[model samples]
Target: MKTKLICALTGVGLLLFTGCTNLAEKVLDEASVSGLTDKQAADGNIAPVYARLPDIFQHTTYFALQEISTDEAILPYRGGTDWGDNGIYLALHQHTSTSTDPNIRNTWLLLLQGISRSITAINTLPTINDPASKVYIAEARGMRAYYNMVMLDLFGIAFLKDDPQATSDILRGEAAANYIKAEMLAVEPDLLTTVGPGRLSKGALWGLLARLHLNYAVYRDRYADTFTHKPEDMDKVVEYCDKLINSGQYQLSKDYFPIFNSDNHSNPELIFAVDQRAELNGHNRLAYFSLSGDQFPIPAYVGANGTDGPAITPDFYQSWVSAYAGKDPTVDPRFYKQNLSIYSNPGDSCVAESAFNINRGILRGQQYGLIRVNGAFVKCPDGKYKVGKLFNTTRNKPTLPVNFTEKIDFTVAGSDYSTGYRVEKYEFSKKSVSGRNLGDADIVIVRLADIYLMRAEAKLRKSNDAAAALADVNTVRASRTVTTPPPALTSMNLDLLFRERGFEFYWEMLRRTDMIRFGKYEGTWTEKTNTDKQKRIFPIPQTAIDGASNLPGYLVQNPGY
Candidate 1:
């Protein structure tokens, strides 16, 4: 049975959801909202609000603006041809991007879409007439605040409107931070604290609140050298982290890969994540974006090729090597995960035969995968797959037997594309040949480990207690599968904490924010030699301003742009 509830919202607005095809003829009228239970319509309204998040995380979009612009990753033109969007990427890496950057514009539009839909849901949900309706309304408001928080983080100003036709108001700095914190805190009592890692549970709310307070000083004064950290704010951060820890619903996982694997929806570490599935709205960019075109993790599956994008900076790669130089690096579980065939596919069985079956955390040595001869996989008479060297069409040469160097000098020709080590943190989906297609891994947003890390940083910053901070970090190191950990730190400081965060969350899209707060964003690194404090917050896209024809001067571009 399908229920169709169509609320004719006035003015320019967004449809609440792309799914829920059931909302049809029967529930199309305004009066019909009374006929269905609140839970039923709640699912219908809340979907589109959550839908906006996938855009920010999608590869080649807003996520590109965050990670590629930092010292952690780069999307240099491959072989002097590929990913050459007329210097758009180069501009981003150098902090020379203007308001006309497409990514900046798209992010603004996508976030506003969420804000609009949430308002619509809040306005329409009450008429459902079930007590459960109020709960959904609260959820809608929580989601709205979360979306605004993201906007404020990226653009320095969040657009606010109670109705679709209302003039958009701006909130920035501390005001925006307080708005996000208060909204989440007010409604969290009714949020599903016990029900989900996918849905906005109380744990998720607390994790976000903890992040807001922990970074409160940064948001309050982004360009300041000695950031003013309020004890009250840091105390609130500790309080929220404790809330999640005491809830007893989440824990740090022993094996790091499982927490980020294809089936991570059930992972205990995931406080909140996008419920991405292959059958639903799932994109595999996370799994294979950094992979070279020739390295096929799944031979039987074919659709789109790897983008070969956003390789880790040589600087970031060396950070690990230098940090654990004296100790055995293998003991740090987060640094590496070897590829082992647990699938029945004949292609996977061939993975055992590849020249380099080693799927190290940072892919630096000779790359290995399936070889195609005459449109058929080359296999030995014994029926095992035959692994061979890689050849790139761009360079038109078989170099070093396909060895990927750990160093990337972006200024050099052809050297930029292939030099840097590829990121291999997220595992390729190794399901059956029949089931394989796009990636199905949930994109983790807030995890339990990050909560602990936040608490430790809050404590370190608040009271300068290095011993207590070290203990919190050690707890994460102890839980990983890699048993060979670096010796317990004799002391802890801000510099050490920042380095640890880079190692822990590489390629997870927190680098820009981390760099800003650490006062390292303006520093020279590889291609990013220019330093501009205004570049910390991205410009409000000029396209957004021009599109708001109805309200003149409604969207002022960010300071520099």
Candidate 2:
């Protein structure tokens, strides 16, 4: 009876059943039965589905999920920070029992529901009447599949359903992977053949496929009693990576910064990205997290303290600094720009100024210009300044500078640190300031450099010492800082490749996945030392477990929940 109902509704083009508001109103009206053709219903429904993409790909959720899951980024709240509540989850998954604050849970449910709703709308589109409709549906499905992959990685289960109105069908382990694979395969042929460079193309399908298979070893064992990586799984990864690389559809961008700039949407390197409009979806967090005390002078946002800075983990900074020792300072500009101190300058340009190097301690008014012999504080011709102390004393008693470092701590205040190797992946503007909701940079989800690293890992796994794999990895590293090529490979393994990935793609949300693939997911860090079992998947949202009744056994919660 259920299957019969679905078939009949699909045949009659029950657009309202598919949950497309525009089409439902146009065809059936509020009565749910009115005078309208199936064709009109289908056309009207498609636009609303596209409109949902911006909301579905929202950053409020993705940024939290991405940073918390990786080592490259941490959510250390300083004073006067608004994004602190979510940051606490990033630091520790524990949340207050109060159900009123639903950001995390709401984000999870909305992404799942949004993806499901979008897929339902795409499935309802009338067949092939308009070429544009086909493209739109293809994009929608790809996005749906991508979102599903994220869910599987983070939650270890997906809400599987054939019909739009059906209840959520939870699938775990291999069952989940198989379902995701089937969806990708079903949509592969319909996607655009060549979607320019950065946009989603059939080639991008191969990239996503590579990602799925590369992590198959983990996904397949996420909810199982024991975990093991099969040789065949590695073969599948190599297969998809080869398709993406050999297809000649994409290439690494010459300049790494261009990949993250506001003008980066059309860059050839990006395989897929969530488009962020300045006025609509622009991220103020980057500026909010990275702005130093000087740029955001105190008594403005906070009473005596100024801007709270985002602090990089001490270990992460050491790793980069060690890698670049004795090498040309200009070798990889990204290392310095994305992961170094901001300098103090009185001029307008930030990057062009000399960096402010000071002791890593609290800055007070006495220390402002105490040791300078020339009486002129070493100010950069450019406006860049080291993110240290925020001086907020009035000119009458300017000598008594209050130590505003408390504003940068994670617990007391909500201030996000923009100090100590701040991320410069996206270009920072002089006009942009923290506390002001303004930024116009597009975030990169999948880029060509990532593909090269993926291909390298796959090839190393398949054929240990393959020169082609080594060359592919080296090509990407070479592009950063424009230095001598990396050493030729005599031997290769997942560990070496994973470390390379860590260095190549830090804070881009691939850290946790990379860690899992290399068997480092459960390794201890400053605050977390989760076991392998806990590492595979996050505890099912406590709310979900409490909500389920009928399928108590069917929905066995992941261990350690």
State TM-scores per candidate: 0.88, 0.73
lDDT of 2: 0.53
- For candidate 2, lDDT tens digit of each residue in 57-131? 343455545555455554454433534665444444221112223444544555564565566667666443555
Question: How does model 1 fare in lDDT?
Answer: 0.72
Candidate 1 structure quality by residue, lDDT tens digits, 24-62? 332235565556566767767767667666656777666
Identify the runs in model 2 with alpha carbons over 4 angstroms from their true place. 1-60, 77-87, 90-103, 196-199, 223-227, 277-284, 293-310, 326-330, 338-420, 428-439, 480-492, 550-556
Candidate 1: segments with Cα more than 4 A from true spot: 1-38, 302-305, 340-360, 393-400, 414-416, 430-438, 482-487
Candidate with the greatest TM-score versus the true structure: 1
